[model samples]
Target: MAGNTEPLSPRAKLAVTAGKAAAAVSRAAGRGSGSVIGGRVALKLDPDLLARVAAHLDVVLVSATNGKTTTTRLIAEALRAAGPVVSNALGANMPAGITSALAGGSDARYGVIEVDEKYLAGVARDVDPKAIALLNLSRDQLDRAAETRMLAEKWREGLAGSKALIVANCDDPLIAWAASSSANVVWVAAGQEWKDDAWSCPSCGGVLQRRDDDWGCGDCGFRRPTPQWALSGDYVLDPHGAAWPIRLQLPGRANKSNATMSAAVAAAFGVAPQIGLERMWDVTAVAGRYDVVSFDNRDLRLLLAKNPAGWLETFSLIDPAPAPVVLSVNARGADGTDTSWLWDVDYTRLTGHPLFVVGDRKLDLAVRLEVAGQSFRVCENLDEAVAAAPAGRIEVIANYTAFQDLRRRVGN
Candidate 1:
């Protein structure tokens, strides 16, 4: 409880120290290290602890900018279809977070950890997983992660000599480029289903032109690699069509990608893809990132939107023709670590009118909401926000820090 959950800034070293102490205690007990809310727990992880645990299971490291949690969560569930599975289920991609996950999963046969791009190198060396799934790279967290290109370069280097069976998303030009350089790669292309790959080519630095299923660089011929498996087919948007038809239950096109990418990773592990996918009975919405729950007899939807990519995707998941909607955002703790990233997000895409706003940083979110000319009602707290929410489904987009604190306060 004496740890610091600060951003990756001046308070990062303190976080590392707290992470080490907390880990050491968890290792000594040989059990899942419980979540610490107060600033009393320290997390100084024991190196020997991992060495002991690593001997029992084949670990899989899943890294990406957007879909790491969902994709890895899906894949870890899929792996369980084959046998017992282990994973860092609580979006703990950093070294200390992963250490806590491992300590928790001391008995698991396999581990699927969602490692952040920046933290991938350290985790790679620590866990040394047997498989890895590289979901995709996008622009996010400008304050924390500099640029997609820079992160990709670091990931490529970290994964340079990895022995894990690589399962990569071949849709993004940058990710596709990383997979090509990987030692053993089994690719999955997003194809015509995904949007916005109209940038430069990953191969020859040429401009890309979209052509149905493929996006190719006209000048140098860099195109999406032919994936081993694809989910490109047909869709009938009958106004009365099934919304939750897909077995995997996360909303939006990105969730579909996350689910399918997990299936592909399962196949690489020599298991039936479909069978593995079915094991994921439901989307694991633990805290933020689409965590739907009830509070005071009302449904509350909490999502983690860090940067432009996440904001755009979350916006995409919302139905434009719903019973209106409510949105709340905050940057109290780690949530609004650097509110500057708000500039990078594509707020224009959220044309879907919102009903209200809440959180400590509501003024900021309100200002943005106002600047974008979207309607919003402000509240001082989540309780007030929920109370103000219309008597129907409510939508909330709380960033990393806000989501956790909100969860505790709301008993989610």
Candidate 2:
């Protein structure tokens, strides 16, 4: 039932068939892609559908506060070098979505799954993946998801005594501590740009001392582990000290870190670093992140930033000043109801740019911008915001629901 390539049982076959029918009806009715609903239907019929569908495949679960979707895409692309790969490329990362993806690609040799941070333990337990990539953990969706430390503790407890290889970011102390319980770990210095969530040591609850790129807890012996793979500028250095250039179409150092971790994970599966990087270079965008779509005679570049840690990275990806940056946010169930995390971002970074705010939570964003001493115009919608900007290339940064709204409007 775990790792064999046996044919699906009668119950699982019926469940998968019913799930596919539900997805088709949902899509025809224009009610979204229906991956979530399909998986829901499947699970209702067979509770163990995920395990049964994933039994034959070599699974890799990718989880993080951010970049899990993009990282999942990157890993899937690299793993394709070996054989067919199945992944939830649309960002449906929970149990239902993952089951849909795996069930859809029953013939794929590898399974690269993007898992929600809160559901990682449950998904990992069900899938029994060959590798689990612990990217980085930070405070996100605090109203719904567990607190940063609590999630880390869950990971440590959930993954204890697992046979899967843990490819973790050692730069993040929380991630380091969470992945520490695993017997097999491939430490990667993937660089943590946002450090607010890791001020305290997860081990002894003492203050973590940081100097340059190293971090340690003076009270306890827990510290940054020596990594076998490291991201150095534009290249990734392997364990043998050979530096391979990471020529990726994805922008920013964050993506480079993702690529490095992906390569390391692929290498664990016998895929060479050079081969993996070569395959990864073909990925230009993941689920419309960093996608440039033309609307109203102007090209709108889409960027998704859901939390403070995500906003920090989005700021770095914004176009230079005077490009007219549009900020949008929504506090729907998908996006955490509490918008307090907006204040944690440094919006002053957009001082020189022409700023436009729009979305269901645009007022909340406007107040945060005002408090940060930045000027911005409030618009009724994305069209109003884009029309207000000078016709050319514009940068649009939005949270979960807002980004999807604009993405749909632009026909992307």
Q: In model 1, which range of ten residues has the least summed lDDT?
A: 235-244
Q: Put down candidate 2 lDDT per residue, 224-259, tens digits, no spaces.
A: 999999999999999999999999999999999999
Per-prediction TM-score to the true structure, in the order listed: 0.80, 0.99
| Model 1 bad stretches (over 4 Å) | 1-45, 48-51, 191-198, 202-205, 233-246, 288-291, 322-324, 344-354
Which has the greatest lDDT? 2
Model 1 CA lDDT for position 82: 69
**Across residues 119-191, which tens digit of lDDT does each residue of candidate 1 receive?**
8777777666777788777765556675676677677777788787777777777777766667888777543
RMSD per model, one decimal: 8.0, 0.9
